[model samples]
Target: MIFSRKIPLYEFFPKEFVDIHSHLLPGIDDGAKSMEESLDLIQGLIQMGFTRLITTPHIYGSVWPNTPEIIRSKAILLQEEIQSRKLPVSLSFAAEYMLDEKFMQYLDTSSLLTIKNKYVLIEFPNFQAPLQLHEILFRLNSMGYEPILAHPERYTYFENVINNIEELKEIGCLFQLNLLSLAKHYGTNVYETAIKLLKAGVIDFVGTDVHRKYHLDTLKKITSKKHLKLLETPFKNNFNLW
Candidate 1:
């Protein structure tokens, strides 16, 4: 099939962009290490034409183990820093939750950070999806939260199981493809998968998932017209629908 659907994309990045996923928070998870580095990364994203950012640090129970209070405190500090520097960007914080057994505690308490409205960003294990993945998503839905599966293309286990991805949406899960995946930053398989999802129009949103300047560098180098065209739909939907 010839891909004829198009969203208005600019010569560079679209101005209507609101990067819903990133790891710009310093000393948090595997993202930026220090406050200075965080500011620098945010600045680079701003230069790329992103007007707003919802930086999502990992909230794995065993690893990052971040709490909502801790995330909010850091966000307040970062917002002050941005103001001090007058970055002219809207900054917010949310957690990229690992959807696992440990996550039940949060669900039990109904304590979770939202990206917008009832939407929450979640990441599944790359090795294999949980046996009860659908049930978990159902639980989230029952709690009045919608899950946006972060970087679905990077999940190698389901590379050949395209219908499994469709099943995710059947219950409740929107797919968020990483922008770097299109640049082959994750690998060729991820790039191919991202393209497949884009062509299928299965990807609902896109993000830099910018862990470092290297990510920004790769994104900046995505100057090919074909590549940029593939990005237009996600960008437009993220800005308008979200």
Candidate 2:
């Protein structure tokens, strides 16, 4: 079933890919354990047609508490090493700002690191949407950052309320769909919700969200040509596609 498509990997990836979500930076959170592992993962990603990887390490306000300075320093070190090793892929850093009280304070001080300092990726709690979401988005906007809600399809509260994501878009937040979700890697419910969001034209960006080898191994078996076709649609022409 995986190779039913005639083109194989050739036309599937007509160009080198741009993956907006990854945890490839070594020893930050639960991603790659060491620099050697990270380099290996980068090489694997390159062979998968990935040209750019925006590595977003988890920045749990109370738990991880990663500052912009630390994130940038790590990113710089890895970027230089990748270049020195002559790897053909690019690496950049952003924080996966888990929503919390301290995150709000970081927004107030404009200290939250983002992709290009324009697009900020945020994650919610697993089971429910916080009541303070609107206020958080308002504060993020006031600080001149566009909040990109990561993996909205995985949220159970929005499982039947897909329009809520659109409401967030109205409030200046974009939705980034996890590519694995489309493959049903999470579950049937999340997969169905992901397709619902995709068809409704609410998804603005798609990301690999690669955290480990198991994630990449799972991706190798995804034969959803429709998912790839949906990704190539006109609705995917968001500004970040570049």
Candidate 3:
């Protein structure tokens, strides 16, 4: 569906919505520790009124190393199991790629994980922004992929240099905001930073970024919070998943 760039936020979002970021793929990454746990998490999301989920399993370097093959296989398994149970929620696969040498090498070789294979979801080191990020982003654009920075508000390195977001955007990066950040799940600082981005209209999409039931539980609280009105504002695109 088409989205108007100037549409009000409330007008842009339907009561039911699409959650684009999640880690519900079973036995992958730190989310949904097992198949049973993954099913439980998606069921909870369904209860929360989300109809479509693009679950992004982590593809870190040393820690939660995940490949597209692993992600696709897991996603297919979950799809089959969910169908067998007759659950109605829709699921898709992507990866939250850690910005590292392995990923850079892959990018050079024209291989990377992305949502819909159009936007690559990437995260920087939490403590410091990488020096080569600009070059990497440029290369991604040249390769016909958009880089989506995940949870920009949670990075402490950005606390003093928030304008870096504008620079990233200028360089063709899209930003994905974690809904829990609006509820102070990370901290009051993160919540405030999230609010700033929301008001600025810099966030291109929102996601649960859910790793487990606790996250969904916290999301319930976030859905109730007042500042959620920022998200209630209309998006430019009709991303109404439900």
Taking every candidate in turn, the Cα RMSD to the unseen true structure, in Å, is: 4.4, 2.6, 6.3
Model 1 misplaced regions, further than 4 Å: 1-11
From the highest lDDT down, the ranking of the candidates is 1, 3, 2
Q: Write the per-residue lDDT of candidate 3 for residues 1-242, one digit (tens) a residue.
A: 99744322223235446667889988878898899999999888887776778888988887987778889899999999999999988887788988888887777664776676578888888778877899999988998998888899888788553587888899999888887786679999888888888888777877779998888777766543345456654233317322
Name the best candidate (by lDDT).
1
Which one wins by lDDT: 1 or 3?
1
lDDT of 2 by residue, 14-50 (tens): 3645677778888887788888888888887887777
Candidate 3 local distance difference test against the native: 0.78
- Write down the lDDT that model 2 would get: 0.77
lDDT of every model, 2 decimals: 0.83, 0.77, 0.78
Each model's backbone clash number: 0, 0, 9
Best of the two (2, 3) by TM-score: 2
Candidate 3 Cα errors over 4 Å, as ranges = 1-16, 223-225, 232-242
Candidate ranking under TM-score, highest first, comes to 1, 2, 3
The residue pairs that clash in candidate 3, if any, are 3-236, 3-237, 8-234, 9-233, 9-234, 10-232, 10-233, 10-234, 12-234
lDDT of 1 at 68: 87
Residue 108 alpha-carbon offset, candidate 2, angstroms = 2.1
